[model samples]
Target: MILWSARWKSRIGASTIRGMTESSTQKDYLFKTIGVIGVGLLGGSIAAAARQRNLVETILGAGRNPSRMRAAQQSGLLDRGTTNIAETAAQSDLVIVCTPVNHIVQFIQTVAKNSRAGTIITDVGSTKQQICEQLKGTLPAEVTFVASHPLAGSEKSGYEFSDQNLFQDRPCVITPDESVPAEAVSRVRQFWEALGMHVLQTTPVKHDLILAETSHLPHVVASALAATLATENFRYTSTGFRDTTRIAGGDPTLWIEILLSNRDAIVTSLEKYTQSLQQFKEAILNNDEKQLRQLLEDGKKKHDTLNSAP
Candidate 1:
């Protein structure tokens, strides 16, 4: 979470004194204490990244899972891990909400009840528009809310599967509103960069639109394919089917929350996809060889374009 004050404009480039050492105070401006509200893959990875880079002096991990929190503490993923969410939120300068989308608002309300006035609040949710809207409706005027989406994750879950380098060279989207402090936004960007990510900026609306097509659609399609192919009588599938459906094996609990939370955007994307599929179906039914060839060519070109690096 990154919060900005009206006076931050003057403090943007100025150095701050921390512990008797002025030493290029730019690094200390962003965040010194980070609170991660989930100790699973996303939260553990964030804590690991902060530790690996010494990005944060302290990190507090919070989750309902006692065993997971203890594992995170023992594994050096967080300076402290606790089952109490309010306790973690109170101590953190910046709190990263990494819980399921369904739990986001509840967590925010809990944090508001316990956290100090100036603590920043941000999230790593795939959908931003809804989250941002919820924040505007619920959060206090002092607590700044920045919606972010990290475009990196493995199919694996849990603290044991977390890797320090999970964010390396990956895209992290930071969506800040006009009300958000410029300094706060910059600090959030800086923090992500420190974690070895390529940061990009966008509005919550724009982020939702773009991700609905490129990211959400893929997951929906992959899941649909996986569901369609599974039958009691069916047997003996090859590598192509296995590879294509691999992401469908993602945590159903997580995906259910995601799909439901971002229903509007996903619905719009699915409608467009249905139209495209209808075209392909019609071409196949009519035995339109040229149309089929052109579609394949277009698909190949699109895949190539996506595969090109930044």
Candidate 2:
């Protein structure tokens, strides 16, 4: 509610994230033309990665801003750039919707309308339930969908901050219901794997719940922690504080949609986190050395796992 972090601005998907990881191999062109909608960090990085690995024949970018699209095209990240959503969809064999959670369902519908038969469409959205459920039975019979979320991003936005290696060694989740074809799912998987991602598969419901804790909940906690300081205390902050609150710098507009779409799961995560926090507080308040040490040890043990995470 408090729009405090946009000033410092500059982030998703992590989840029981079980998946198969294949090593980077000889890059073969995966698709004829790949269309990317909303060429922000993830989208731009996808475009960049495809180009760097020569994964596609052509990369087309779409956005509301014509100038920005044109700039991305000029940078060679996109072979074509336009404000025309239908054109991008029609020309693409694979369409990657990189828009925010709220816009994805509607926007992909527009894309599906204009796409040719057998066009494979995927997304890098934060939440999967709303999008996957809403589009479940709705996409044109000719178009195929495999909802996905790549668990890597920066607190930065835009094409300039995007790196071709952004998806490298990171988990890229794919959520496909039973109706989607195995061939279609493989097509989406091949695309991400070519970009150096370790592919993960899960139900949309599971993806939503898992990411709410690993991704959405952290953003919420980061924002809450960042908002505690007064402007006068800004100069007193240091690297540790900035690192802890780095995600708080993400675009609020994008995150609000994520928070709302995954409301129930995020609330559950918040409840769990708060319960843990209360224990820490009680331990400190009572100056209970044994309890404090145990709590700290538990947190350390859990956090250390991140060091070995793939």
Candidate 3:
């Protein structure tokens, strides 16, 4: 399935024939060129990390925005950049779809036709179930498709904000269905680890449910809290209020897509959140000092535990 191969070697050094053969086979049969389908913060960071560590022989970026693609190329994040997804997929040994959640299925479909046989495909989406479902039917059987989500990001977007070390020691969750080859899954894990990330494996459904509470709920609550405070007492706000709501200022379009794509899990999370809020409200209304104090103390303890956690 591969077109060519390259063995890792220094100009002045030589390798055993067996070592060279294995390296060449790994480059050709395992991985070589890595394609990133959205060179914004997450994609750019991945590309930069791969290049920094020589994880792949080449990194190519593709996106609708030519300007961002050019920026990624000029910033040393990618070896090449283009607006054509097919070209990127066709040329890459590994393809990481890093576009917004809403665009992921469409992008995969767009590039699927041109993806080479045995090309390893992956994604960096917040939710994984819908993405896995779409890829299950549309992606070619020859292409090894695996879903992954790296648990690292900033409340920022755009290529300019990308950091090469964004995934360093971060938890990168991989969701592979039964149809995925064991070797392919291992290769995907090895690739993420090569980028200095710790790999965690989970089912797509589990990932969606856990993240709905641990990730999406926090973003929604932060935005809601900021909106309520700004409406009622913006004039009295200070650094503490600003810091707490900082993530609320994240890209609205991106968040909306993520929320809508994973609506079922998010709705479940919201129901639990609303029940907790109602309990607090009832405590205040009944003038139950003990209940109110317990609620506040519990919240403080939980926050402290999270802050102190590894």
lDDT of 2: 0.86
Q: Which stretches of candidate 2 lie over 4 Å from their true place?
A: 1-28
Residue 250 of model 1: what lDDT? 83
Model 3: per-residue lDDT, tens digit, 74-178?
A: 555667889988899999988998999888888877667789888888889998988888777777787878889998888999766767689987899999999
How much does each candidate deviate from the true structure in C-alpha RMSD?
8.0, 8.9, 6.3
Q: After superposition, how far is residue 277 of candidate 1 from its true place, in Å?
A: 2.0
Cα lDDT, all candidates: 0.79, 0.86, 0.82
Candidate that scores best on TM-score: 2
| Per-residue lDDT of 184 in model 1 | 76
Error of model 1, residue 34, in angstroms: 0.8
lDDT of 2 by residue, 1-310 (tens): 0121121111001100111223223224579789999999899899878876757767899999999888777666677889999999999999999998899999999999999998999999989999988887888899998999999998899877778889999999999888999999998998899999989999999999999999999998999999997999999999989999999999999998999999999999999999999999999999999999999999889889988675
- Model 1 lDDT per residue over 1-310, tens place: 0121222222222212333465544455467788998777888788777766657667799999887687666555666788999899899888988898778867877876678888888788888877777767677776777777888787888876667799999999999888889877877888889888999999888888888888888898988998887586357787888888778878889888888777788899999999889889989999999998888898889889878956
lDDT of 2 at 284: 93
Number of the predicted model whose lDDT against the real structure is largest:
2
TM-score of each: 0.86, 0.89, 0.86
Q: Cα deviation in Å at residue 108, candidate 2?
A: 0.9
